[model samples]
Target: MRANVDFEDLHFERRPYDPQVAYAQAKTANSLFSVEATRRWQDHGIVTNTVNPGGVATGLQRNFTTAQKESLDAAEAAGVFTYKSIEQGAATTLVAAVAPEFAHTGGHYLDDGREAYPVPDDASLADHPHGVKRWALERAGALRLWEVSTALLTA
Candidate 1:
């Protein structure tokens, strides 16, 4: 985000403080980080997974103004984003955490209770597609990001 760069080339070390792109980078990093955890913890019978729980209208948006809330409502109405209740939004993670089907399905991203496809969607509140980006599953990038995050945290 600090650096205007290609989507595939997001660098964990170079990630800046730009709220917009930085948020996306952080989301990508979380998915890749989950992949790393799945790799290192699988033999221990540990499972690590990630989920994009879609959009949920809840107290989380308590700060949004009327206009902003309306914007989200409009988007959901237009099928640009899927709005769910707090309980409904937690469904995917709840399944990933306890569902037997995911016991061996580590290192994957889920959308609506299934493996997410790679569908790049418009981000202008125009269209919201539920899919993980290809970069989110990059093992090498995950490892690198793990190192960077560890070093930063430790320092």
Candidate 2:
């Protein structure tokens, strides 16, 4: 969502979209999107939560460059990243989709089938926090992104 803001404010020519950055930010926005959804629909028994279905060995890697694949493979070898099977990756999603536990923590971010803490701005953390960033939870930004996306869809 904020990607649109960056693209709009900076213009595509001035700030060409970085896929990785946009993707991370988009995931952040997704958490906020859930937050906004929870706020708006909680009264109707809708529980909206974010799930970090940990890395899966999906065809997503097809887009990676050979060098990127090498780096990822290295990370996997070093126990830094583990690409789960599709079934493993889908576990959390299935939980969030049907788990009664999520009904109470509607706005929480889940990882490994548990709610995770909000990660700070620091990018060098070794633990690789599996939670939403504070920026993604900002109510104003959520509402703004929702409005902008809605406008685009309507237009």
Candidate 3:
């Protein structure tokens, strides 16, 4: 994706993954893309990073039935979790955009103005070396879906 950019007009934001499993994969992909792009364009000073705003009460929860939401709320109330308001939801994103600490932290995940932890040892990815390489492979698969259409139009 970085290989075909018009930097002067570059502006893009990815959607958040809803399902936890998909979200994890998306997060991983986001990390890899940022790392690979930064390495591929370090001279240009391009930066990329991931931001997780903990939990937010958003319309995305519409997919969850009332009972589910209630259960979630109950769980949160029990001190097992917490959710953020919309303003709080945007905090990490804001920090990512302007925080001095992030000026040099690339290919990392930030949450609530600080670096967040990654998922526990998942054997599927724990054994992999060169995170960016894995990301490139996954992104290559994603690119394949659009390659033909892009070629046809550009040609």
Candidate 4:
């Protein structure tokens, strides 16, 4: 059976590192993984895709302290920022999982129930060509790491 997953929804919001940075890296890894996995598993009838649900005020947001939380909440309430509830947050994943429209073997990012683009950082945009090449190299490195780790455990 085919499965559709969104990596952003699985983010660890409370990590010590910057949340945006972490999410960006995870999103990159996820896109690369989906592309590589589909290529490797297509013969077995497997398909994979990705989604990015902007910001949702689920339990994940509880990681913020009182002051930070208040600021986020105010921004969200003012309509200046878009923050979905937990149920709303799950909508993209649900659509991806069962929607025939997204059956194609590709990746997508969703925000507010529609197809959306990732908000690229200024640095990333400036290094677009270099970023793409680096991402390709990183994917190869990740595959090697996976191989070595698996081999060590299964040897």
TM-score for each model: 0.72, 0.82, 0.59, 0.56
Residues 30-148 of candidate 3: C-alpha lDDT, one tens digit per residue: 55556555555667777777777767887767776676678778978887667888899898899999998778657666767776544334323223221233333344533442353
Global CA lDDT of candidate 2, please? 0.70
CA shift at 3, candidate 2, in angstroms?
Answer: 9.1
Per-residue accuracy of model 4 over 43-119 as CA lDDT, tens digit each: 77786766656577666655556766787678768775667667877887887777786676544444345554443
What TM-score should be assigned to candidate 4?
Answer: 0.56
How would you order the candidates by TM-score, starting with the best?
A: 2, 1, 3, 4
Q: Write the per-residue lDDT of candidate 1 for residues 1-155, one digit (tens) a residue.
A: 12122344455455433334555566677788898998889898887888878777656576666776787789778867777777888898988888888888698888777777654433322333555666678788788878877877899
Residue pairs in clash, model 2: none
Winner on lDDT between 3 and 4 is 3
Evaluated at residue 117, the lDDT of candidate 1 is: 69
The global C-alpha lDDT for each of the candidates, from Candidate 1 onward, is 0.70, 0.70, 0.56, 0.53
Clashes of 3: 0
Candidate number with greatest TM-score: 2
Per-residue lDDT tens digits of candidate 2, residues 14-40?
665454455566666687788888888
User: Candidates 1 and 2: which is better by TM-score?
Assistant: 2
